[model samples]
Target: MALRPAPVGTGIVFTRIDQGNALLPAAYDLVSETRLGTTLRNGDGVGLAAVEHLMAALWGCEIDNLFVDIDGPEVPAMDGSAAPFVFLMECAGVVEQGASRQAVRVCRSVEVIDGDKRIALTPADDFSVDLLIDFDNPMIARQSSCFHGGSFAFKTEISRARTFGFENEVAALHAAGFALGGSLENAVVVGEDRVLNEGGLRYDNEFVRHKTLDCVGDLYLAGAPLLAHVDAHCSGHGLNNAVLRALFASDRNWKLEPVMSALPSWSETAVAAEA
Candidate 1:
């Protein structure tokens, strides 16, 4: 992973250097689909996958401007979590730019549901997330957690939460010619009341926490920091992308503002200003 300083107002863009110099703007219009993970496609056939977690880390850290150049179809699934990506960014050191930071303010509640899964964005002075997950497995019956955005605390609390899967599903994934790089080192595996992997879960509720991590990343596609309270239940990458698309589809639901150096506190101002 590499961090390159971006031009003012560039936002976070992913350029597929492998695909004939195509640029995919990290926005809702570029979202091609949500299959196993979030995917973005440019008109020139360049695309990126599994970008939500990295996006979340950048957004959560309040990095408003960046240019990401990747030479592959999918980003390196380093340890299958966001912690490594966070570490890389920390090592690179985030620098403050002369440009102002912009944010998307949610003015109303917007929600999307597919079957029993649902995700919602509500008005808030600051960005926050509440995530809930339910699995049939006994180890991960139901889990939930909340995060106040812009807090790097999430790096420790949730970033290391690993992607999980069942043993039966692994065979299917291989047959489909995916996860060639996946292994026990990168993913958590469970089988019928027992943890198949030698190492157990990093956290008791890692499943839900990973979902929260994904929410943070996918929501960043708004192309700006957002001030809203997000609540989600048993949602995946597809649903999260849908929620973003819904918010942007209606201009009445939200507004984008350029970053400002001076802003009133949430309690002091009737409406929070961009920063």
Candidate 2:
């Protein structure tokens, strides 16, 4: 797959070369499914699955327009993190377009809840995330992350975090043809008493950090980058998409704003890539 430059207002589009070159938009309204990951389907039913990691990387890098040429059904689950996708964007290098980037400035707080899980977005002068997770397993008891910086912080503190699953769940996932490409090499598998990975962890609480990374990708489905503080607990892809729908339904909930200076690191990195 390759990322090609697109004109302003193009948003993110995925073209399937094998599927008669069908195009699908990476927008919330185009989201046809959100099982374990986000799937975008066009009216003709041409689909792309598990795009969150790539989308998250694009959001972190402040990339607003692009054409993704893919020969397969889904983006490769490279190492189960956004870091690889970040690397792809950096190598391609980003250039400023004639128009300023747009962001959805939250005006009213929006919340979505499903039993014990919940997610909310509140108006803020800057973007941030507050995430919390708790599991029944002793190995991954409770973890929380609060991130307050932009691109650089995401790469250093959140990007390297890999997706994780339980040993008991892996067989079931593969049986269902869900994680056929998943392995200990791409995901951190946890046993009852310890992690199965040889390297232990990239961070002490990598599980929650990966969840925060997913949240970043999920929220970008709003069709533009967000300029609000987010708070989430025990929420996954389902609840994330629900919250975005609710936020977009209410007109007073958000407004568009010109890009600010918070994303200088991505711009600077792009320059370094071309040197």
> In terms of TM-score, which candidate is strongest?
2
Q: TM-scores of the models, in the given order?
A: 0.90, 0.92
Q: Per-residue CA lDDT of candidate 1, range 136-185, in tens?
A: 98878988998774546777787888888887787778889966656677
Mark the regions of model 1 whose C-alpha exceeds 4 Å error after superposition. 258-275
Best by lDDT: 2
Question: How many residue pairs clash per model?
Answer: 2, 0
Model 2: per-residue Cα lDDT at residue 244: 90
Candidate 2 C-alpha error for residue 13, in Å: 1.0
lDDT of 2 by residue, 61-125 (tens): 87788888899988888998999988878877877666667788999999999999999999998
The lDDT, on a scale of 0 to 1, for candidate 1 is 0.77
